[model samples]
Target chain A: MISQLGDGFLALAQPLSFLHLVGGFLLGLVFGAIPGLTATLAIALLLPFTFGMDVADALIMVAGIYMAGIYSGSITGITLNIPGAPSGAITTLDGHALMKRGEGTQALGMSALSSAIGGLVGVVILVALAQPISALALQFQTPDKFSLVLLAVVTVTIVASGPLIKAVVAMALGLMISTVGIDPMVPVGRFDFGSYHLVEGISLLPAVIGLFAVCELIAQSSIPASLGKAVAVATIDRPRRRDFLPSREKIREVGLFTFLKSAIIGVLIGMLPGGGASMASFIAYAEAKRGSRHPEAFGQGSYEGLAASESANNAMCGGAVIPLLTMGIPGDAVTAIIFGVLLIHGLVPGPALLGENFHVIAPMFAALFMASIFIFLSMMAFGPVYLRLSQINRGFLYAFIAMISMVGVYASSYSLFQMWMALAIGVLAFLLRTFGYPVVPTLMGIILGPYLEEFLRRSLIVSEGDPTIFLRSPASLVLLGLTLLFVWLLRIRPAVKRGRAEAAS
Target chain B: MTRLLRGQVVFALGLAALNTVYASQLLQMDRPFANGEPGPAFLPLILCGFMYVASIIIVVGEFRTAAAARESAPQSDVISRIALIGPALTISATALFIVTFFYFGYLVSAAVFTFIVSLFFNYEKSGDLKRSSLIALITAFTVTLFGWLFFVKLFGLYLPVWEL
Candidate 1:
């Protein structure tokens, strides 16, 4: 596996491919530094770029972008009050407060060191545990797979931010779209709607780009100027006397302690359906604060908070990749896209993981390691300089994003229709964002919907249409039972109590 | 209703309408399976049913909110009705853009199609010609670069490209 990964890296070492790594890192930095420009948006835009490239190069670029993108959010979080990414929201607990106290550079420095260490540690876990995780995945049967996907889809109904009805509608809409292409078991088209293009159903790249990125742009345009202004970053004239070594020593002490703690947190969260960097970072931040000697200093701007978030979030990189590489389950949105890439590359993640394809794991691990180091060195050399983009005008800003969206959509297969699709969806997404419909759940449903349906359908097929297939498989039964238990605890029981209490009142 | 509620209502309604349309599509579906088992349209109808019920619940909930609010303040209801128009126009314009995709071509069609879009939101500053056009040109160029360089040249799938 290690040699395979080395080969993957060596393949990427060419001037062109190596430049792609740098380009991707730089792209992540810019996107992460921007308050609303997210890794999701970046990857969506870059999807078109992949329409013409090798799947390996495309996957490598996006993966690098994703890893560094999660890490780079702290740069803005520490220097500016804004979190460049969702995962970095916790970093603002202490990062911005510390920046106000003239430790902006110091915080950024700690963020860099901790981010690198945390990412490296996470990669180590990925290397060691991926094989074991892959082995566990082999135990899954068709019934298990189907039931698991159901549990995943149903899990959203309980935890979605909006009303359960809205969540259900969104999920149902996604499932309907999933059936547009040729049916897996059957030969003829279902919802192709008479168009040859429809025979392929809705393309994942264009559909996702439209739903998330385009919609965001529309919402952004509608926002009042007050909401548009990004958080201000105080200038650092003295630059904290350049004390990174001291900070590193301090972080090393903390990193040594939280390394294991963060890895455990990341793994636990990564195994969940919606568990991604955001949740992992949040959990790690809470744990770090819980264990810190200076808990009072946390929200006010503690270095430990920064360390915890950067490390845990980056460590989440490995955790998120585990299911993707081994079991074909996507750990998060970004990995969901990676699942798309793996499928495009003709790698069926399940049985393929146990075979000679052990080669894919090593290269992915190595790429992640390289991407992390690149983020570290890149941030040290160039992160501080780009802290001033908040001042850019709205028209130009959205225009730039629109341009990327256009070029990216068109590039994704040289298709004008895809561009229109992006613009169409961007407009809708923009509206949705304005309306406060959480986009994440919908995206999650879209990405996971098909797999879940296939799983459920296949399980029924295997069981001769017995719905009890879910009950018969130990794994399926456990997953479904746990899901039901969670729903009862989180929603049904809580609602019941609320109803009783309200009646009494 | 706040802008949030209006959006939820519209999306819910739109999804309900989509379910009706998709269910129709499913009924018309060609059955290709040999086993005489449930075919492509089977689960799709189930899915549409799910969409319908979910949308109904959402609309009912939002409508209840709208009805309750009407007794307190009619002005908010009027404001919401007015605000919903902008999005309706925006979505209609998007459908128009998609419909005319081949005629407009990727670059020209998107620019003209969405120029009013950018203008509708950002055209108040008449004095800033350079910035606005620069933004427009950049937007157009983005269409070209992403379409040509990234998707067509690199990833190389047959997307819906437009040319002479």
Candidate 2:
């Protein structure tokens, strides 16, 4: 085992491999920084480009991008209070407050550093436990997989903030979208309406990109700007310019504890399908506040406050990959895109890969570590420059954003139709935002809908479309019970509490 | 009602209605499999049912909240419900631009969209054609750069080049 690990380390040390990690990291940060761009979008957009590249190198690039993407999102969340991605949403609470307190540099530093630690720690756990976990996963059959996914669905239902009934509807909205186009058994087009594009069903990536990015833009346009304009980058910190910007001592203090707690949270959350870095960050922040000696310092921009979220969100990545590579389930949207990339690479994911391919598996683990280190150093070096990027004037920024949308959407597929679709969706998203409809779920739906639907279909096949099949499986039944319980907890119970509070007051 | 709140209700209702119409049609159309098993319709059926219940719940919640506000509050301080027209018109213009661009061409569409949406931002500022033209020129150049260099040159994709 040790020898194989050494070979993996050597392979990753090649200058090209290190370079690839750096490239992926920076690319991810840039994508993550942009409002309409995200880590998953970045990966999918980059996929066509890697069609001819070496598989190992390609995987390394994707991995680096994935890790860095999650980390860089907090940059925007902290400084601008606009999440660079959904996962970064938790950071906005304390991170942006720190910026408002004129501790932008400190928050940025703490977030970046802690995220690095979380990511690296996650990588270590992956190295040690992935094979063992995958071996355990082999015990799962269709019943288990269905149960696990159902458990995820339950989590989503519980976390949703509307009427339990409404959230269920929204989830069903996603499932409905997934069943379009073709049924897998007959493999014949079902809802295509005779269009070639429709036959392929709705492309999940475009839908995600549309619902999250484009629709969000539309929503933003509708709202009165309540918050001050997103903050402008004030200072560029380089060692040459200033020995160090994010006070290393402060970073170290926040980074260590946050990273450790975040890793545990991430792995546990990652083990569950519905849980991801965002939830981990939210929970960790709440925990950190609860346990803190300085609890009152929480929403007011405490250094440790920012650290808690950044670390946990990054740690969730490692936890997420455990289920993905081992059990053939995507941990989150990032892993979902990676799953798409894996398919593109001709690698079949499951116990078979774990059992037979140490050559691939070992380096992949080492690459995760190298990628985290590479991005951390690169962020320290180049991240301060990004402060300037955030401050770009709104008019200029809008114009450039428009330009980016036009180019990015059009470039990926020369089809004018797709470009138009992206614009339409973006505008719609912007409008939706104006109206106060939560937008993240729409994106989550687009990404997860297909997988959820696929599992539903396969479950039907294994059980002759009997609803009882879902109930008979212990895992599925437990998950269904949990779902019911969660609906009661988040949706029904909250409304009931509010009702009682209003009456008393 | 607060104009903003009213708009949200309308949009929410519209969204629910759209889901209902589309999902219901789908479930109705899909035939069951031959073996007396549930078919593709099952998921859609489940989805439509949930949407129906959820939509009703959401509207009920909205109305209850709205009613509670009406009893206590005095007249609203609406500057103008027309203030919403800016966003509405801007969005409408965008949708129209998308429709017309393919129907006519990019150049015409760009000119029209730029002219109309400018009204939303600063019609007075746009009167300074010096500034508006400058911004418009930049917008035009930006479109060219993104459409040609980034989209076409780098990625081997094509946009509707309205050179004429």
Candidate 3:
């Protein structure tokens, strides 16, 4: 494993591969630092372009984007009080407060430093555990695989923000979309609606582009430009590179223990299906506050709070990739799209993937580690530039997005029908968002639906129509139990508490 | 009904109707467990039933919430209308772009689509027609050129240039 990883590092050192990493890093920074744009969107846009690159370079570039995108979400959050991505929301609580206190540069510096630490720790743990976990996963039976995918589907549905029913609806809609074209296990056609194009099934590229890029374009169009102007009107002071370095005393104040603990919490959360960066950072921030010597200082410019959130969120990037590479289950939108990327390259992501293709996948791990280091260096190099990222002209930004997304879809498939499919899905997604439905679960469902169905059918066939096969396998039993447990812990418990509070009031 | 409730009900019903179509297609397939094995329609049949139950629950919940909101406070129609114009225009422009791209090909469709998109954003931001059009023209040219270079020259992906 170490030798393979060494080869991965050597691959990254090659000039073109290194350039791909740097280019992807810069792209992630720009996308993640700008409000209304996300790392998920940037990666979705990059999907079509991956067709032209080597498989290793494509994966390496995606790793750089994933790491940098998660870290840079805090940049705009600290600067303008608008989180560039959802993962940065917890950071904004303390980060913006620190900015108002005129310590914005220092806060940015501390954020970058802690994120690098967390990211390195996540990569180390990932490298150590990935092989062992894949070995374990290789032992999974059809029923066990079905249970695992079910756990992912249900957890993702429950964790999505808004009413649980709405999330479920979104997920069902995605599963329905996936059911189009042909039956996975049988040779019969289903849901083709009498069209040859429909029989080919919806491709992953257009679905991704439509869900993110086109949907974002339509969503952004509805918001009045005055809101953006208001954000741009805020006065910002020019700061030099030296201003971004955290003081030694401040570093000691946050402490190494806080960084390590938060990072570990992040990795653990990330290992769970549907455990994303936002949840990791939010839980870590709460835990940090709980253990703080002065809990009241949090949310009032506390460096500890900022460090905790930043560290955990970046670490989550590595953790999120674990299930994706090993089990072929994507934990969130970014990894779901990464799953598409790997599939596009004719590489199936599963237990056998690592044993067969470790050399190709290794550089991605190295890129994640290097991108973390770049996060810290970038703050020092672009401190001033980062402050002004949110002010880019909306006209130029959305126009560029609109053109690339539409054209990119056509380029990838050379099919005019797919372009129309993308636009139609985009419109539907816009409606889904406007009505308070979360889209992440919908994306997850599209990616995981086939596996969920195939496994269930296969297991039932072996059992001769006995559903008890799921309970017969110890691993399947455990996974189903965990799924029920997560529902109780994440949803039912919270609702019961809310009901009690309401009754008391 | 309040506009908010109306929109929610319409959207929910639309989904239910789509589900009905999907279920109808599922019925056309071989039944579940046909020939002593589960067929292709097995999981989708389950999903169809689930979607129907969930949709009814959601519609009822939305109605109850709307009734309570109506008793408590008046809803704002003006804000909703103002918020909708941009999306309406964007959707129309994008649909038109797709049609034109089919007939006229990439170069013309891309340039026109980008021009209109840039114009809408620029005009919305500044509310100045002349200035917005000028900036939109420049943006359209630059973006279209860059996209061509990136997709065609760099990636070597074939794009239709002039179908007409």
Candidate 4:
């Protein structure tokens, strides 16, 4: 492991790998610090670019983007009242308050410091835990794998931010879409509907582009571009580079224990299916407030609250990658795109990935570690510029996204049909969002549907059509039980409680 | 029912209809249910059942919560009504740009696509054609040139310019 770590650093030290890291980090910062843009979009746009690069470099660049993007979400939250990303919303409760109190510099500094610590801890945990988890997962049978994928599908659907029925419908729709093209098991066409292009099935590139980039474009078009006016620049004073460094006294006040605890919380949340940075940060912030001596200071410029959220959200980057690399389960949309990257590079993300391709994967782990440290360096060096990120021209920005998204789709597949497919999915997604259906589950369903189907059919075939095969295997039984447990906890329990309360009232 | 719930009801019904078509198609496949062996249609058939059930639940839920949903419907209705000028126009513009792209090539296609998008967003913001068009033109040129260099010159990826 030590030698691998050393070799990882050596690989990252190459001139091209180093350049991609810096480029990806800067790209992530820009995207994360923009209100309507996200790290997912950044990576989605970068997908085509990665097609021509080495797998190690591609993974390394994605690593830099993931770390920097998750961390930079707080940059705009501290300087402006608006969070640049969903995960940064929790941080804004205290961060914006600190800005109003003339402690913006200190808040920004602490955010960077806590993110670095949390990120480092998360990476260490990821490295220590990923291989062990992969080894255990390798022991899984077809039924067990099917049950596991079922758990992921259900968890992702139920955790989506809408009605349970709507999420289910979205997942079903995605599964139906995945059913298009040729059938995986039978080598027969299923849902092509007489179209030649549909026979190939919808690829990940268009689905991702349409779901994120094009959906964003249509959504952004609804708002009058003038609406997202930044806070008055004159009110906030620019700080010197020295001011961007968290003072030792301030660090002592936040306490190292708070940082470590929040990071652990983040890592654990990230490991769970449907766990995301926003949820991690929110839960960690709440926990920090509960544990703080000055709970009242939370949401009113408490550095501890800011630290908790920033640390946890950044740490989630590493935690999210763990499941993706070890078990082929993507914890969130960003990791979903990373799954595509792995597939594009001829690397399948599952138990065998680590044992067979540890050399290629090591550089990404190292990049995450280095990018975490770079977060502090960037915060100190370019604190002022981060504040002005939202002020970028909207017309130019969306136009660039529009061009790159469609062009990227075409370039990757060399098929015009895929580009149209992207637009079609975008329109469908926009309609779904308008009707209150969450789009993430649809993307998840599309990505996981094949695996879910293959495992189930294989298990059924092995058992000679007995449904009890799923329950008979110990591992499969445990996974199925966990799925039920999640449904009871997250869905059934809430509905039952609500029903009882309504009756009593 | 509220406009939102009404829309959802229609959507749910539509989805159910689509699922029926999918199920019918599945039945057309060879050995869809060959005894004991799960064929191509097995998983899809299961998914179709789930889709139909979920769609029904959605429709039923909308009816059950119609009163509560009505109170919140007006706010969203205003936004969606405004979307005619906002998203509708932009989507139409994008569709037009794409249709023109194949015949016109990358330079003209990209420039026009960027120009229309930029103009719409800018005009929506400032409501000044002169400024919007100026920004649109510059944005169009820069974005088009960048796409050309990056995809064509740098990465050497193929993007059809002009079939005509």
Candidate 5:
């Protein structure tokens, strides 16, 4: 393993691979800093080109993009209050507050530092525990897999901010969308609605593009531009490169423990299928607030809040890869595309992948670590420029987004129908958002729904239609218990406490 | 009553109606029940039922919340017509772009899409057509060129420049 790690580092040392890493990191940074664009879109746009590239190079580039993208989401959030990605939303709570207080440089610095710490910690844990975790995951049966997916689906819904009923509805809507094509088990069409295009169902790429990119265009159009003038009006001071570094006192205030705890939380969440960066940052941010000595300072530019969120989201990168590398499960959209990249190169991501292709996969690990370093370096390089990122012409930004999103969808599938599908989904999502429904749960529902149904039906078939089979398996039982525990902690307990408090008052 | 049966309430009803249709379709499918083996339609049927119940709960919740808010404090209920027009124009513009995308292909479609979208956002911000038009024209050309170069020239992704 050590020899393979050495080889991985050596491969990354090659000039061409290093260039790909730099290019991908820069691409991720640009996409992640720009509102309405994300690391997912950057990878999606790069997907077709991966056809010509070597597998190792592709993985290396993707690693760079993933790490840089997740970290850069906070750039716009800190400067503008518009999080470049949903993962940055939590960071924006404190990050934008700091920016409002004319400490944008300090906030960006702390964010970069925290992201580096989290990402490094996540990668270390990934290297150390990936094999063991995969071995344990391999022990999981069909029923257990169902319960695990169930745990993911329920937890995402519970964690989604809004009315629980609306979140469930959003999830249900996603599952329904996933069910549109042919049944996985029987190979018979379920809900084609008489159109041949419907038989193909909705592809993940178009759905993601429409939901995020297209919906963003429409959402931005709705808001008057006068609202954003406040950001421009704020007087920002020009700072030195050293000023981009987190102050020693600020680091002391945030403490190493908070960073470690948040990174650990991020890694654990990343290990779960469907546990994306947003959830990692959210849970970590909430925990930081819960455990803070000065909780009231949390939303008002607390450095600890920024550190907690940045650390968790970046750490999630390492955690997310664990399931993808060890098992074939992709934790989210970015990893899902990486799964496609592997398939194009005839490299399946499963238990055999590690044993057979450790040498080939090593550079990707190195790239992730290197990319984490770049996150900090990028702060020193572009910390000043990021403050002006929000001031980019809205006309150009939205126009660029609209072109890439629609064209990217068409380019990928070579199907005009898919582009239309993206538009339809985008409109639906825009309405869903306007009506106060959280869209992440919907995305999760679509991604996890097929697995949820397949495993459930397959388990039922194995047991001759007995429901008790779920509880019969120890692993499944334990997972289900965890699901219940999450519900209690995230949902029921909160409601009960709120009710009791209201009564007491 | 108009305030009580708001957009959310209407949306919930619409979803319930859609789910009912879905449920009926499931009933028409072969063996949706879990009697022998859970058929292909079984899961979808279950989902449809759940959606119906959830949508009903949403409507009820919205109604209750609206009632409580009304009783507690009455605020101005007027919503600006202009606010709705912006989103409408944006959605319609996007839909128009999709139409043009198929008929005109990548270059013309994207150029037009970007121009109109740029105009919309720019007009919202500045209310100056001269500035908005100049920026829109420049953006349309550059973005189109970038798309053509990146996807077609660099990556070899098939995006038609023009179509019948």
Candidate 6:
């Protein structure tokens, strides 16, 4: 295994493969640092191109994009007070505060450093656990698979930030979307609405492009440029290269314990089916605050707070891959898109993916580790440029996005009807967001719907329509119990606490 | 009624309507349990019911909240007209782009589509027609060429150049 992993690193040393990594890393850095553009969008746009590339190269490029994208989100968060991605929201608390204190360079430095540390830790853990987890998952029966998918769907819906009803609605909408074409269990078409295009069902490419790219384009159109310009006007003095390096005293202040603990928290959260970078960072930030001697300094330019958020979110990139490669469950949008990339290249991500195709998957693991080192190197290389990312012309940016996304859909499928589908889904997604429905659960629903339905029907068929079969299998029982526990802990307990607090007030 | 409440009610009703359409399709399929095995429509049937119930709950919740707000204090119901216009314009332009792409092929349609998108954003930002048009024109030329190069030349994907 170690030798195979070494071979993975050696493969990436090839010039063409190395170029793909650099290109993807640069793409992710730009997307992550620019508000309204995310790594998920970058990968979504790259989906079509992957059809022409080797599977290993495609996965490697995605790895670079994943690591760089998660890390660079905090760049603009520190400098501009606007988090480039949702993952950077927690980092923005202390990051922007430090920026206001004329410590912007140091803040950026600490963010990159901690992110590198976290990403490295995550990759190491992924390397260690991915194989063992795949072995465990290979033993899952039909009922157990159904239960696991159920846990993912329920947890994602519950953890979504909004009215619980709305999340469920969004998720149901996605599942319905997934059910449009041919039934997974049967050969018959279900909900074609009498159109052949509908019978072919909505492809993942258009769905992803529509839900994120088209949705974002329309949503951004609603916000006036002056509003964004107002935020961008807060400028900082240009610092020299040396100033971008964190001082020894500051690193010591943040402490190694804080970085490692936050990173571990990130990895653990990331391994869960619905756990994402934002949650990982938020929980780690809270824990960091709880464990700090100077808790009051948090959200007030504390290095400890910034390090914890940056470390955990970047670390989440590595941890998020474990479930995706081992169990075929995507924990978040970015990983979900990566799943599409793998599918495009004829790679099925599952327990057998590692066991049978470890050689093909190895380069991706290597790319992720290498991208972490590049995160620290990129900050030093482009520290000044990072501050100016938000100042890009909206006209140029959105126009590029509009052209690439729409045309890319056509390029991949060669179907104008699919392009239309992308547009329709985009509009629907725009409306969903406008109505305050979280879109992530909807994406999760679409991806997991087939698996959930297949496993449920298969299990039922095996049990001769007996519903209690789920409880009979020990693994299934454990997963179902976990699902219930998560609902109680994530949803019921929170609502109860909120009610009590309101009554007390 | 407040705009928020109005929008919420309309959105909830829309969802309910969509669910009804989906359920109608599901009814045409085999029953949930067919020949002693769960059929294709089983999970979808469950989802269809869940959607109807959830949509009703959301509509009721919106009305209840609106009633409480009305009793508490008067509030402005106006939503930003400018905000609505931006999305309307963009969506219209995108629809137009699709139509043109189908008729005129990739090159002409892409140039025209990118021109309009670039113009809309630039005009929104600077609110100056002449300068925005100049920038938009430059952006249109470059982005159109880049898209062509990327899809056709680099990736070896087939795209219609000038079908017309």
Query: Which model scores highest in DockQ?
Result: 3
lDDT of 4 by residue, A49-113 (tens): 88998999999999888888888888888777778888889998898898888888888899999
Our tally of clashes for model 3 stands at 0
In candidate 4 chain A, where is summed lDDT lowest over 10 consecutive residues? A225-234
lDDT per residue, candidate 3, A51-157, as tens digits? 88999999989998888888889988988888999899999989888888888889999999999999998998889889998999999999999999999999999
Ranked by DockQ, the better of candidates 1 and 4 is 4
DockQ of each: 0.28, 0.26, 0.61, 0.59, 0.51, 0.57
Better of 2 and 3 by DockQ: 3
A best-first ranking of the candidates according to their lDDT comes to 3, 6, 4, 5, 1, 2
DockQ of 6: 0.57
Worst 10 residues of 3 chain A by lDDT: A227-236
For candidate 6, write residues A346-428 as lDDT tens digits. 88988899988899999999999999999999989988888787788899999999999999998888888988888999999
- Candidate 5 retains true contacts at a fraction of 0.69
Compared to the true structure, candidate 6 yields what TM-score?
0.97
Off by over 4 Å in 1: A230-233, A238-255, A414-436, A485-505, B1-7, B29-36, B63-164
Residue A52, candidate 3: Cα error in Å is: 1.2
Candidate 2: tens digits of C-alpha lDDT, residues A123-233: 878777888977876776676666666666656645655445544555565566566677755566665556676677665445545554445334433433323245453
What's model 5's lDDT at A306? 96
Docking class of 3: medium
lDDT of 6 by residue, B114-160 (tens): 89889988887677889999999999999999998888888888988
Chain B vs. true chain B: TM-score for each candidate? 0.46, 0.63, 0.89, 0.85, 0.83, 0.88
Q: Taking the tens digit of each residue's C-alpha lDDT, what string does model 3 give over B50-97?
A: 989988998999988986544212222223343577788888888888
Residue A418 Cα positional deviation in candidate 4, in Å, after optimal superposition: 0.5
TM-score of the B chain in model 4? 0.85
lDDT of 1 by residue, A279-310 (tens): 78889989988998888877887777777877
Clash list (residue pairs), candidate 6: none
Give the per-residue Cα lDDT of candidate 1 at A472. 83
- Candidate 2 deviant stretches above 4 angstroms: A1-20, A31-62, A76-107, A161-166, A194-196, A223-258, A343-368, A383-386, A395-434, A443-466, A474-505, B1-9, B12-34, B67-129, B139-143, B156-164
